[model samples]
Target: MLSTNSTAVAEFQRKSAQAQAALEKVRGRGTAGNGATSAMVDAGGRLRDLTFAPTAAKWGDRIPALVLKASRAAEQDAIAQVQKITKPLTDDPRLRQTLAETKSLLSAEEPGKRRPRPKAEESEDAYFRNFSPHDPR
Candidate 1:
């Protein structure tokens, strides 16, 4: 029994090490305002670098917003990188089952605390029609 437990623990450690290595390889980059601003984030979603074009400061009051947008893009890029690397592991049946179980447990609520589900739009066309003029679609 002790041997079995020890083996399981060792396997877990090995998997954990592999995951850490993959995460370390993750590098996310984000750009805003047609390359006017940019940011890079690591696997842990920590900012690694930021750059701005010479004209970036001319935007004045919009500088903060531009920086925020670029930062968000970088964070998303990092998350995508991590997801791409871990896809195989995440696709495991055991992991899926565990995630589903955990989600259900977390979503459970008392009788009076249940939230109403939002109704789906009756027409998909109506949803698309609401798109802004600037939308590519």
Candidate 2:
């Protein structure tokens, strides 16, 4: 029979491979300057595709700027995609750290940015009332 240590190692290796495979399925795109141009990339940081609006061609002289913007966007997009793809693995600290590192690199927007959090429906005191010893059973 295999030792517990070996089983754990085997499981870790399996999970790592699964995480990488899940990342491969994540496709991300970054659009710049109102989506006039965009870059597509997979979570692996490999460029996949690009898009340009008709007017974008006129900015050929600014290709370097455009490329930089698109790359940043692509990186951010990839990070987001990878996060979603690997949600299941996030319970593992090592996996979560790996994903967070990518997100830090992209400076991805805060998860709560778009929507303001709703006010607490119940206050702490009220929450305790439900289980408080002071309350009669």
Candidate 3:
């Protein structure tokens, strides 16, 4: 029993370290304003660097808007990077099963008692692949 508990703890620690490392390794970049502006961001969309092309001088009053666009792009790029890096963490079937078990143990309600979440509408390709005249939904 003690060995089992210690192993679980070690596994949790290892996963946590992996997540931290993935975040630390993330680097996202974005460009906007017709290549006149560019920015680099880290995990939290924190600005790491910024650059402006010679054409930026011609943009004049448009520089501020270009900067905003570049920053927003960089932030989105960072978010995408983080998602790609950490996807495996949540994709593990064992992790999902463990979470369900933990929830069942901790909650007052009966196991598997939660309401079903609403799913997004399927894409046309998916719908066509499983099409049935009687099944409109």
Instruction: Tell me how many clashing residue pairs each candidate has.
Output: 0, 0, 0
Error of 3 at 111 (Å): 14
lDDT of 3 by residue, 8-49 (tens): 556766887888988997777888878999988899888999
lDDT of each: 0.78, 0.73, 0.80
Residue pairs with backbone overlap in model 3: none
- Per-candidate TM equals 0.56, 0.51, 0.67
Question: Which residue segments of model 2 deviate by more than 4 Å?
Answer: 58-60, 80-137
* Residue 29 displacement in candidate 2 (angstroms): 1.2
- Candidate whose lDDT is highest: 3
Candidate 2 has which clashing residue pairs, if any? none
The whole-model C-alpha lDDT of candidate 1 against the native structure comes to 0.78
TM accuracy, model 3: 0.67
Q: Point out the worst 10-residue segment of candidate 2 by lDDT.
A: 1-10
